[model samples]
Target: MSTRSEALLARPAAQLEVRQRITVLLTPPGLWLLLFFVIPLGVMALFSFRAASFGAQRQVFTLEHYQRFLADTSAQRLLWRSLLIALETSLICVVLAFPLAYFLSFRAGPSRLMLLTILVIPSWTSFLLRILAWKVLLGSSGIFNSLLLSLGWIEEAAPILLFSRGAVIITLVYIWVPFVALPIFAGLERINRHLLEAAEDLGSRPWQIFLEVILPLSLPGVLAGFLSVFIPTVGEYVTPLLVGGVDGIMYGNLVQDQFARALNWPLGSVMSLVMMLVVLVLTFGLGRGVKVTDLAGV
Candidate 1:
């Protein structure tokens, strides 16, 4: 036993050396996140418990902010609305992105890079500009109304499209389309053609192939895209402010107002924490629900 133990102990130190090297490499990013992400979150959490006076000053630590949200029915309703909108946006993006991604991966062939260039080109312009452009295209006196009027299809301009819930969805969809497409496209592109071909050779119909192969493989990308859109959209403030009105304003706008205008940082910080926790729970739950790893590359 001793001889065997010594033999094992006497093995090359290459594994330990490699591990040490890896540790050295990972330390920088670890420290960077510890300083930036963890530290800032800690600070925000500390502030979240503090009491806000009538004039924006925070006093000693208190549970007022946290309790206030729990007790406020309107705030709870607004939170639900924010979550629903985010989910809606994510669902829409995922539904639209899947086919486009499949096309880019399977049909576009070597031209994908070029297609991707055009697809993502809309991002070069400012997001606000994009929303404004949608306003011009959809508003009462916008181009669509003008076109319909020119054709004598309408007696008057369409209802003012600005400052509506639909408009907000349209603008946000435009802003985030690229985000959904890129990940799904990359996922589909990583699929092995042979697997698909083999499935087809076995007399699987197109729909069957897609159901049994393509979709199952693309689950990871779908989840990733969902996360990308849903998380941010849950906290969406700008789209609601620019394109939506009182009815369209989300929980994020309220949170922003709490901090910026109302000068209620304690509530804002608490709200932010609650929103983050909600997002984390939903992300993990969705990942588990979808079995995200199998389609990780897809």
Candidate 2:
């Protein structure tokens, strides 16, 4: 009957209510994930193990798909090439995005919003359209070739501009640069102006300040941007299909061929799973070394 005893007794009830509320709130999203993501992934995994047979009365599971993939040197090479391309694209995006982000964060002043809008406007258009636009620009008689011809850089149109690995990387970089910049811009915006002023007061040169302070603090955003671009680029098939020739074909194109052209769902599933695993491993491996606080210079 004491007040302390009563309060202790009520605590369990209060905890129960909180738990119930949390469960209720989480139920919908949990179910949604199970229904959509988990189920689909499970189905895909199942398909990867299933024997490659059409309209068979009995279903047989085997490891042959994985065995075949492992034995295929060309597939392995293509996978590595895709990873290399993705890394290249991500690095290029970061290099090109940083300066634009820095300017928007520090120098755009009253025009920051307008410039940012301009950066994002291109993204509002269809993704396919953007790629097609680049296709046109890189074509033999496209604007770039014409401009070069007029400038006497080349006597004839450069046929090598389009339908190459370089073209795929170029188009991907252009598509991703604005997106990458936004994250860097956000990170830069979070930086306290006082830090910059203090560095200046200590007589640090612009380059020194950037190297020691700005770069350190902006690393999280840079990593974010890099990963964002890298992950997608690794699985990119459409860009390579449209612009990249045989020499430019990536692992994604191989996977696409399995499902679309070859009608081999099991093999395609195995490839897709392998690509996903590789991406996940790389992402975690990269992220494991750097913490957000470390990147923020906190």
- Top-lDDT candidate index: 2
Give the per-residue lDDT digits (tens) of candidate 2, residues 1-298. 5776556557988668767878999999999999999999998899898887466711888998999999999999999999999999999999999999999999999999799989999999999999999999999889999999999999999989998989999999999999889888888888899999899899999898899899999988888778878988999999999999887899999999998899898889999999999999999988664455433322
Most TM-score-accurate candidate: 2
Where does the lowest 10-residue lDDT sum fall in candidate 1?
289-298
Residue range 1-298, candidate 1, lDDT tens digits: 8676566556667557656878999999999999999998998898898887354455577898899989988978888998988888888888888888888889988998898889889899988898888878887788888898999999898664667767777778778877888778877876798989999999999999999999888777888888888988998999889878876889989899998999888898888999899888988888675444433433
lDDT of 1 at 193: 88
| TM accuracy, model 1 | 0.85
TM-score of each: 0.85, 0.88
Candidate 1: how many backbone clashes? 1
Where is model 2 more than 4 Å wrong at Cα? Answer: 1-29, 289-298
